[model samples]
Target: MDKMRAMELVLEAKSMKGLTFSEIAEAVDRHTVWTTSALLGQQQMSMTEADAVVDLLGLDMDVARALQAPADKGSLDGPVPTDPLIHRFHEIVQVYGTTLRSVIQEEFGDGLMSSTDFRIDVERIADPAGDRVRVILDGRFEPYRKW
Candidate 1:
């Protein structure tokens, strides 16, 4: 089965089982962001992780195999995101891309942050005026080395 089909099955099973991503991650002893990415077909899962997910979701071996397959990362619909929420992220990068780059360069010096070594935390904070969405990105900074 293809990754898309596996993703559909996972979503349906998740809904039917009333399971949250966090719950699944907890069951599999993985970080929520990575688990969620794997479930959404953005990342590959290890054999052990696949087995745990399959057992938890009562999925077939095909699903587990699909989860272990290499992922086609950054599979977006178009150059620019159409979804409002996703579009906002694109907009943020457009606005702050240079500032972020400059700040990071100045602070860390001539290097880049590694997405492979990244962690993201999303939280909701309650407020009287309005609730706030907090997204924290933690990535290891890799400096450029002259050879």
Candidate 2:
């Protein structure tokens, strides 16, 4: 099966099985965010990881093989996101882009964060009035090369 088709089957099986990303991640012994990303085709998976997910989701071996293929990455299909939730993230960068650049440059130097060597986390904070979600993007800072 193609990666996209395999991804669709995986999603269907996951929904039918009523399994959570956290559960799948635990079964594969991987971080939830990374596992989710791999399952969504943003990242590649090892043969073992892919097999475990395939077996857990009751999917075919073709899905496992597809998951092990190279990822295309950056799955967004437009210059600007139309989905409300995703758009909010784009809006955040639009609003804070300059400030974030300045802050990072001030603290780290003239450089960029390494998305290739990054980790993300999502957490829930309980409050008396409401619950809060915290998203953390942790990436290695790479100072600019002065060649």
Candidate 3:
């Protein structure tokens, strides 16, 4: 089956089984973000990981095979994302992108944060005004080599 179809099946199975992404990830012994991205068709899974997910989701081998296939990463529609949640992220970058870069550069020197070696954690913090969404991004800092 195609990746899109496989994603649909996974979503259906997840809903039918009332399984959270964290649960599925735990079953496969993987991180929730990576597992969720794999299920959403944005990341490739190893054969073992695929098998574990298929078993947990009660899907056939086709899906397991599909999970091993390479994904079309960053497949977003239009110039600006229309989804409100996604748009908020874009807005954040637009507003704080420079500030973040400046802070990181000042602290880490001339270098870039590696998305390849990144970990993200999301949490909720209680506040008197309203609940706050806290996102923690951890990535390796790679400095440019002077040739």
Candidate 4:
């Protein structure tokens, strides 16, 4: 099974089984964010992780194998996100990207966050107005080397 096909199957199984990404992550011994990305084909899974996901979701070996393949990064619909939920993220970056960069650089110096060592978390904050979403993006800082 190809990666996209595997993702489709995983999604289908997840829905059919009424499984949450957190539950799948627990079964595979991984973080919910990372496991969700892996199951969605944005991240590759180790053999053990793939096996666990496949077993839990009742997927096939072919799907497990597909899960181990490298991801096709940035599979967005177009230049701009059309989905409301996803578009909010794009809008956030558009509004706050420069401010974030400045603040981060002021503290960390001339360096960029390393996606290779990144970890993201999503939290729900309780409030009377309404629930709020808090997304945390944490990564190691990598400075540019002066050759």
Candidate 5:
């Protein structure tokens, strides 16, 4: 798995669900796959566009650093973190991912659980029964496949 290619594909898919490479290339001004020239400052993203891409792509500091700096490419299709913290995070998603998928699929056909175009707010709501953790997520729905 090519990390760069995979990142590109993920971003493309997030931006345009169920679309092909050509379609994504058309939507974004940048090349379908990031190029060396772009990294070397020959090409650039406007601040807003860059931020949008970052959010849409779910890119972290490590990925941003990797993109800005060249290094030996590692296996993209590899095991992820198994540390306790990571496992806890994974558990949240695993538990929620399927339920969210089912509900979203029922309401919006087949698409993604949009992290982009989404907002998350965590709050504590006091109840006579107990204190509850409230997580509110809002986003536009995009269905990737037909139900």
Candidate 6:
């Protein structure tokens, strides 16, 4: 992926979104004229700036890195599988990473819940109202203090 090409694509795509250069720059959290001129191919992005541009544009990880360095194109033998259930689980992990971190810090006063020392168990229980699934999690704690 050429970084210059990616920037050009972003600039061209903005027209489809009906956004002005300044509007597009704000949406990407960059300075208006800088982002505009860069997108227009008036300036080349340094490696660090290119990385930030990639993140701002939400471009593919491979495409973003390829702007700075050569990218390895790995091959997959067959069709990629799509499982909604597994996708939901992945989403849960992503959201929970932040939410659980905040909750842990609040509960433990800037401490952390450790994955290395973690344990989990799941079981089904029969209740008068309904059958239910239960999960138990335990982990070691580590604290952080700021100077």
Q: For residues 79-101, write the lDDT of model 1, one tens digit per residue.
A: 77899999888765554454455
- TM-score of model 6 relative to the true fold? 0.35
TM-score of every candidate relative to the true structure: 0.55, 0.55, 0.55, 0.54, 0.37, 0.35
Clashing pairs in 2: none
| Stretch of 10 with least lDDT, candidate 1 | 94-103
The clash number for model 6 is: 0
Question: Which portions of model 1 miss their true places by more than 4 Å?
Answer: 80-147
Query: RMSD in Å for candidate 5, one decimal?
Result: 17.6
Stretches off by above 4 angstroms in model 5 are 1-89, 145-147
Better of 1 and 2 by TM-score: 1
**Cα lDDT tens digits for candidate 4, 13-90:** 988998877799899999876777677677789999999999999989999999999876545444668999988888
TM-score of 2: 0.55
- lDDT scores in order: 0.81, 0.79, 0.80, 0.81, 0.48, 0.56
Compared with the true structure, the alpha-carbon lDDT of candidate 3 equals 0.80
* Model 3: how far residue 146 lies from native, Å: 57
Worst lDDT run of 10 residues, candidate 4, spans: 94-103
Better of 1 and 3 by lDDT: 1
Residue 65 lDDT in model 6? 52
Top of the candidates by lDDT: 1
Candidate 5: residue 10 lDDT (0-100): 49
Tens-place lDDT per residue, model 6, 1-147, is: 564566566655554555565665565466765555455443445566566655655556554554444322211133333698665545444434443554465457678877799998889999999997776778888887678
